[model samples]
Structure formats: structure tokens, C-alpha cells
Target: MNAPARLRVAAGQATSVPRDVAANVATACSLVTTAADQGARVVVLPELFLTGYAAEEWRHDDSLALDASTGSGGPDERLRPLADLARERGVTVVASAAVRRALDASTLSAVVLTPDGEVRAPYDKQHLCGLEEQGFFTAGDHGATIVVDGWELGLGICYDGSFPEHAASAAAAGATAYLTPAAFFTGSDHRRDLYYAARAIDNGIYVVFAGLTGTCGASSFSGGSAVYDPEGRAVARTGADDPAVVVADLDIAEVRRVQDEVNTVARDRRDSLGHRERLEVGRAG
Candidate 1:
């Protein structure tokens, strides 16, 4: 079999229309088109790009109800056209949407759309931040790793990035790249920037992070969408306040080189030690 194609990924960072599902979907489609024109093989949009991140307002709005797709049906019918666009352009599109999980009546979630327009398995944000999303959304029980064009891709939402375990778990699951769709605020931008880079270093994988800009509800987002190489170096980054598409030609070969140099995975072999520690703790108790 021929080797998988090396993907040129684009992280589309822009201001979203809060509570405006139609406009948001249109904007995302436009961005995807633009990215395809620019020769991007894979495009990643911000978390909850379709409805913005106004959790409480979105949860109550009835009009927004139409945008929510059942997990089994793929993307909403309105957004179905995007899937055709992806196929036409031959680009794997990863866009976020506010969705209703059919399994539980009370649960609303965020999900990713594949280029074929299929909803890849959903990864609801496992950790909700502050009061905004706490009661409004239900945390997802599992994480997903998708392979697109031979690239092992891991998915996570905004608050999920703050925790090391989330990225670590993805890395452990053989993810070569971690993709985060975030709506990060101003003061927290620097911390997030550093944390993403650190996660790359720790996991020895590339990180493609996109964040929303402008104001959503009472919160203002910092638009520092970036791509980090396996060595935890920023290969390409946008300004914290700029609305633009950040593109990077990632070298899959470099991933292996860095992994060999750092050897974090090979050297950190304490698997048996963990069991020993647990046993010791049990005895002590």
C-alpha cells in the first residue's frame, strides 16, 4: 500500500456569532472554502464555532434548537452542505458544533465533523469550567482519537486542555497530534500558550490549537491560534487578538526525530512501579 499523504493543516481562528447558528455555519463554511483554496489538506475550527460559547443563553434559546443534531444522524441538515464541500474540495474538515446527545435527554454536547461530513465519534468536554458550563452541559465519558490521512489525531475542547491528563491520555493512546478547539479569555492566554507548548514537550507530539476571538457574552476571547512541533516549539502562531488562518506545513518525519531525541516515552517506563505504589498504599491503609 502507498504511504499516507502528509497533511498541510490549517487552524481557522475567527470571531463567531453568538447564538446565531445560521450565520455561524455560513462563516465556518466560508472559512473552510478559503482554507481549501489555500491548499490546506485538513482544517480545524474553534470549539463550538456553530453557536459560539454562550452556554447559558444557547441552552435556553429555542431557535438554536434547530442547529443541534442527534449524534446518530451526522451533522445537522443545515450543515450537511459542508460535508459535500469537504468532499468536493478533498479536504478533511474538523468543525465543532453544539449537539444534543440522544443517549440522555438532559445532555447537550460539542462534536467534530469529518470531511466526508460524518460526525466522528463525539467527545463532550469532560471538565466544565466555572458556572458558565457547569450546570448547562453534561461532561463526556470518553475521549476519541481519529486517524485522518494517516495522521493520528486526538480531539479535545477548551477546558479539557487545562488538565495534563487529557493530553497525556491522548498521547498514550497513540495520538501524534492533539487538536484543541478553545474559547480562551485574555488573562488566561499566556498560561494556555505555555501549557500547550508544555503538553507538546511532555507528549512529544504536535499540537494544533484554535481559539475564538472578540466578545462572546460577557467573556472576551484571545485569538492566539497556534501549531506546536513535537519538540514543544511553536512552528506557527498568530497574535492573541488577530482573526486569521494559521497554516503550517508539519513534517511527520520531524515527529519521529524529536521523539527519538527526547525519548520521553521510552525513558518514562514506570508502569510496574505504579502498581507497586498502589499496593504499598493499600498496605499502609
Candidate 2:
């Protein structure tokens, strides 16, 4: 199927009720409805939003993580509400949660809930931040892309977006946009501006960053959720520390324009992206 020439997307910034999956899901449903009403075909939510970004909470109480076993044909009961909402609203909802992939295994995963009521966790966060996350969640093996209305969106979570190779891999995989669900802290404005925009410009694709707001455990999130165009311009954005939803119409043609015409970064990116040689430059003594 041919991708849409222009696709409307949204980034959701909301507060997470610590250790409360049901409440968080309910909150996400409301935000999803808002985005759908705004004509967004896809809405991306914050990281670990299902049970909050409380890594210690997850570590202490494993029950907080939803069972997302690979063999399951449908979402678990806890995930059904959001799935039903997506189907009813005909919007693709990208949400994240701590998931138990197996009895002994758990990971922080971003799931794509399609309008057809299908749910898939195409990406598990590869880069875990700090000791809390590193001690609690298992890192994913690789990056992945999800399709909504024929628009390919590469998936990442928080720290994963900081790595240039992560977004570059998505572009190489034919993704027109990169979606990141994050929980950035209050003083990370410089990071929020640099990382998302850099990823968009570096890959010559749309970048949607959905961040958390308010407090989740010991940390306070700055909800600088935004959507950056291919040229790294902020097309849509929410105020820092504000709980809101921001939407933007991403023109796929603009991606082509930047990649092929204006920005050659995407077009000129070599396949040896993973290949790097350390070079030493010494001043002539």
C-alpha cells in the first residue's frame, strides 16, 4: 500500500499515577481520544507510562509489569481498554509499559496498538538509563518499525534516541518518522532540544517525542513533548512541565525533499554505520 502523502500525528505529555496501571491506561485513553479528535492518525505516549517511570517500583513489585508473552494472540485484560479505544477511535496508539516477556524476563517496551485492535511490541528499549533501569529492565536486541496508515514509524524509548545510529537504522529501514517515548527530567531542556531535533535532521525524517509530566516516583518530568520536521524544525510542541497533547501534519514529501534535495545526510549515509575505526591525531612533536 502506498503511504499517505501527509499524515497527522501527535505526542502526548501526561502525568503517570505511580504504580497504577489501570489509572495510567485510563489517562492514556483520554489522551488518545483527544489526539484522534484532533485528526491524528497516530498518537505516541510517554515511556513506562503504564505503571509510571518508577523503576524501583517495578523492581520491587513485579506484578506491575504486564504479561506481553510473544505467544499471546491478543492483549491482556489490562491492555484491552486501550486496544478497544484505538479500534473505536480508528487511531494508532503507541504506548509504553514494563512488560514481562517471560517468567524470568522483563523489559521496558513500547507497543503499537493499531486501529484494527491489533497490539504489537515492536521495540524494547535498547539503552537503559541509570542504575535503576539497568538493574530492572532487560535491553532489546535491536530497533524496529511499525506501520500506521502506511506510514512507517521507527520506535525508540528515552535513552535510545540519544544514539544517532538508532534513528539512522530506522531511516535505512524505510521509516519516514521516528517515535520516542521518554521521561526526561526537569533540567534537561538543552537535551530535549538537541536530541530530538538532531535525530530528525540526522535521519532526514519526522521525529515525534512524547514526554512525561509531573512526578513519577522520585523524579519530576519536564513534558517537552514535540514533533520535529525533517529539517529539525519544531512543528508542534507542548510547554515544559505541562500535561498536553501536541499534533502535527507530517508531509512525507517533505522527507523526500530534505533527503533527496536539501539534506544529503539520509541519502549519503553509508551502510557501514556500525563500522567505526578509531583514528589518532598527534601533533608533530
10 residues in a row with least lDDT, candidate 1: 61-70
Best by lDDT: 2
What's model 2's overall lDDT? 0.86
Model 2 / residue 190 / CA error / Å:
0.7
What is the Å distance of residue 256 in model 2 from its true position? 0.5
Error of 2 at 275 (Å): 10
Tens digits of lDDT, candidate 2, 13-116: 88998778788888999899889999999999999898788765775445443446562245766778999999999999988877777766778888788888
* Tens digit per residue, CA lDDT, model 1, 195-281: 888878877888898888877777778888889988888888887554578888777777777777755663374556543332334
TM, every model: 0.85, 0.92
